[model samples]
Target: MTMTVRDLRPEVRADVEGFARVRRLALPFYLVTADSLAYDATHAHPDSHYRPLVAEADGEVIGTAQVGLVHDSPDPGQGYLNVYVHPEHTGRGAGSGLVRAAEEYLAAKGATRLYAWVLDRPGDRAFAERHGYRASRSAHFLRLDLAGGELPPLQDPPPGVELRPGTDFADDPRPFFELDSETMSDEPSDIDYEFTDYEAWLESTWKHPLFSPELTTIALVDGRPAAFSAARTDGGTRYGTVMTGTARDFRGRGLAKLAKNDSLHRARAAGLTEAFTGNDAGNGPMIAINKWFGYEICATEMRYVRELG
Candidate 1:
């Protein structure tokens, strides 16, 4: 069993599909597709130096790593690598090989701190500890049975609020951009990100193929975007809310909940059978909201951090 690590060839359909396959097998609750992988490989911000890597044995991709610098953070030298090996091929050295390759690449690129997301299982935690990575914050992957679950009935917007699909702002998405930028700053994470580049956002997010404007919902207050639920689909029955947040000024008006519920209904109407979302473990408010919608925590991932000496 000779395992080797190399850069993912975006041009090769097999490589792309194999990487996506490994990810799907390793992290079954999340939404991932070949098209999304290909898009990120090319459209990521240049400063991030994003590289999709694969560990192959006998001409098959057995493991994958998404390695890149945290370019949006104000601080430099912060890198991240999320490595996942196919469950059937776990003991064949694919995971270790991919991790070593990722660390070397990030170190040479001047990264001082590296973070990785490891599942909360005992074996996964032990693996991270063995590699000198210490546990940090954690997050949970949640799922709702969009097809069988009964969602709360839709209600007309309160006096000053209106619900709009993301498509409504197609002519001018700057409002969406502004709302996203503001909400992201409030998100809980180890790294504080600042979204200052509208051009980059437009290129990587607005134009991405998997982003479904029709399924996304925005809550408007007095004609101003207050909160939004951004959706991503795998061009299948799987649908995920990648971001759902309320503007700082709009917090606690039930706008975020309103937006997400509307988005879920829209996804259901669009024939998406499953709804997925992620929440920081410490985010009790958001977790309560998700629970209210019948979303159950499907899986948990622990964030592990290591300092490169």
Candidate 2:
């Protein structure tokens, strides 16, 4: 059977469902849905040149790839392509075909460096090595059973601080955005990013389909957002913390931990059973916070980099 790859058709329900289905099966720790897939396809920045590709075999989408440039990074020519093949559909050449198509697309767009995340399994690592990619950093996918596990009891805010839901800032999220930008700058990563576009943040993050403002917890200092835990739900029993961070000035006060704990409690109270999150290996502080919440590492993925010629 010949494997063919093409751009994902967001308008087609089957295409979106197929892409989401494969990704869910391949990466169970992630929260993916048809609506999220469609939203990403439509709202991606033009400069990023985002493209979702599907490898089809016998009229079935057996693998998927998300290809794009690191548009928000200070450096140019850095690109990313994360490929996921249906576990049952591996060894059918779909993976290779998808990678080749993605690489060609990025290379043509003037990308000089490429990054991909491969599950830290033997076969996956070997595939990356065969493709001239070398492993760099690693990250862990963590899970917590919110329904039955014992969570740390929610505590009252300190004398000067207050805990509020993200919804409280619905009228004006600029403070939250500023706090997000500050914390994001401190995150450990291979790419350095600066969040300067408020409109893009509103469209891509604030209005995202999975974002649950009611469950997200924010820490306030003098009526300003000082720390926050952003929550995302799969519109079901699965909930995840998309981001948990504190402004640099408030870093040592444990405000981030407090915010995330409060958000998790709210999520569990609302009937979310499974909680998921990811952290870079080098993010010791964030990793320690998650550990305090009883989250265990469920899986790991390695970031692989290749210099395009």
Tens-place lDDT per residue, model 2, 141-251, is 999999889898888888889999989989998888888888888888899998998988998889999999999999998777899999999998999998999987787
Tell me the tens digit of each residue's lDDT in model 1 across 120-220: 99989998999989999999999999999999989888999999999999999999999999998888899989998999999878999889999899999
Give the least accurate 10-residue stretch of model 1, judged by summed lDDT: 90-99
lDDT of the candidates, in the order given: 0.93, 0.94
Output the TM-score of candidate 2.
0.99
Per-residue lDDT, model 2, residue 139, is: 98
Model 1 CA deviation exceeding 4 Å by range: none
Tell me how far the alpha carbon of residue 22 in candidate 1 is from the true structure, in angstroms, after superposition: 0.5
Off by over 4 Å in 2: none
